[model samples]
Target: MSYLIYFAIIILIPIYAQMKVRSAYKKYSEVPSSTGMTGAQVARQILDEKGLYNVTVEETPGVLSDHYDPRSKTVRLSSNNFHGHSLAGTAVAAHEVGHAIQDQEAYAFLRLRHTLVPVASIGSNFSWILIMIGIFAGMANLLLLGIIFMAAAVVFQIVTLPVEFNASSRAMDQVVSLGIIRNDEERETKKVLDAAALTYVAAAAVAVLELVRLVLMYTGMTRSDD
Candidate 1:
């Protein structure tokens, strides 16, 4: 039963979230925005209006691969979004710009997330190996270390939820305040952003579930050895 629950969280949830995002993107990507502005233009307008003059908006390859790189202060939009004047494009572009704005304002969660990146990366890379070795060797201390590492990754995932949701919120606000989309179009744009946000929620769920599974396994092993 525990394995089944773990499977659902690790497999089903992310798959469903990805399907939702792809479905929404496909549907709205074909629907042209009334503003008649390409996503690049929309992003640039928002950045400038927000006084993020140093942030560069660039066209990147791949579908739905758009993102904001705080290190370079660049908003990289997928090719379709950079050139297409579609609802999906507009929403995605604005969402990336929202991250740029968050970086400028020094959002607490975002800053903390950045600080955790190195620790989280290390934890993700080595936790599984350490846990497996500890289990095979019946070493409780080593297992505890692995759990601590996994906990770091889990904390990073939980922190990510608010960062993503906040970005979506900022995206909606910018698009509406800038008149990028009409009242009727606002709903469609929001649907796209909302779908994207679900992916992050699914990721956080997976992280939490995996951590729980590890803790349970560790406790069970200790109990059995007693």
Candidate 2:
């Protein structure tokens, strides 16, 4: 019952954050920007201003699928955001460009986060298998090893917050400085970015809670064996 309650609470956070972002996107997407710049155009201008000529902007299929590809030096935006001349679209586009800026500037946290990706991936993929094997064999050390692996995943999620928040902050600054949005429009764009940032926060929260649950379950299992 306790686990269920905790799960119910933690699960709702991401769901709510998703809904909030969607709602904000829908609302602002209808309101056209005064600058009339499509998302791709904004991305291009930001890259040019920052002298990121090597970076390329491309339109990708899917809703809210925008992301920065560090390996390819590319910023991919979803169809709607790529073509839409709305504050929401521009805000999201600038945010992705912010990641590119981070990559270009060698932002310390972003670099650290990138370095942990492989470790986190390995941990996520094999941690469960190791834990189950340990449980069946009653090996506490193996279970603890699994916990450490999952902990790496949790650390990755935690590191992700700074990268995301800094990106949004950069996006807002660029948007305002470039006159892409002004006054009331600036407020609306901030709203969009804020809602989007919540999604990352919720993701980290869920990951931490999941790690705690895993530890608790293993503790109970070890106690039963003893």
Candidate 3:
């Protein structure tokens, strides 16, 4: 039952978070901000203020695909968020810009996460193959190696939590300080970022749960072998 519960949580939480974010974004996307700043404008102003003039803001093709590319010194905003003057658009754009600020400020966790990206990508990609081979061959050492790789991915996800939360915090602070949002708009803008943050929390939770499940499965296999 515990296993089933964990499985359900790993599966359901992300789905719920995604739905919540989409709903919130859709609701706020239609309501234009009183400041009349498009998301691109908000991001540009915030970047310039932060002395990140070298960081370019560009429109990316996709819904909710916005991100900051540290390698390129670019903030990529989704189509609607790039041009829309809505609270949701500005909020998301500001959030991505927050990442650029973090990169510039050398935010500890963000820097660490950036360093771990390639390693975690490799670990997550190959760990499943190692796990399957070990299980089929009754090799505990091989399975343990796979578990270690999965653990690396889990650590990456854990580090990501602080990086994401801090970015959202920075986004909220800058948006208010810059006068991009005010009064009721402040609260609504927060709702948009908070909804998006939940998705990151859900992703971390899923990774942790998966790591635990893998450990338990490996333990079961070893005990059966004994």
> lDDT tens string, model 1, 1-226?
9677768669999999999999999999999999899999999999999999999999999999999999999999999999999999999999999999999999999999999999999999999889999989998778989999989999999999899999999999999999999989999999999999999999889888888877888899889889
Q: Tens-digit lDDT track for model 3 on 1-226?
A: 9778877878899999999999999999999999999999999999998999999999999999999999999999999999999999989999999999999999999989988998899889999899889888988889889989888888999998899889999999999998989988989998998899898889889888788877988899889978
In model 2, state the lDDT of residue 94.
97
The residue-level lDDT of candidate 2 at 116 comes to: 100
Which pairs of residues clash in candidate 2, taking residues 3 or more apart in a chain or in different chains? none
Name the better of 1 and 3 by lDDT: 1
TM-score of every model? 0.97, 0.94, 0.95
Lowest-sum lDDT 10-residue window in model 3: 2-11
Taken over the whole model, the C-alpha lDDT of each candidate is 0.94, 0.93, 0.92
The alpha-carbon lDDT assigned to residue 226 of candidate 1 equals 94
Instruction: Select the stronger candidate by TM-score from 1 and 2.
Output: 1
- Model 1 clash pairs are none
Runs in model 2 with CA error above 4 Å? 135-137, 220-226
For model 2, the run of ten residues with the poorest summed lDDT: 132-141
The model with the greater lDDT, 2 or 3, is 2
Q: Candidate 2 has what TM-score? A: 0.94
Which is the better candidate, 1 or 3, if ranked by TM-score? Answer: 1
For candidate 2, give the lDDT.
0.93
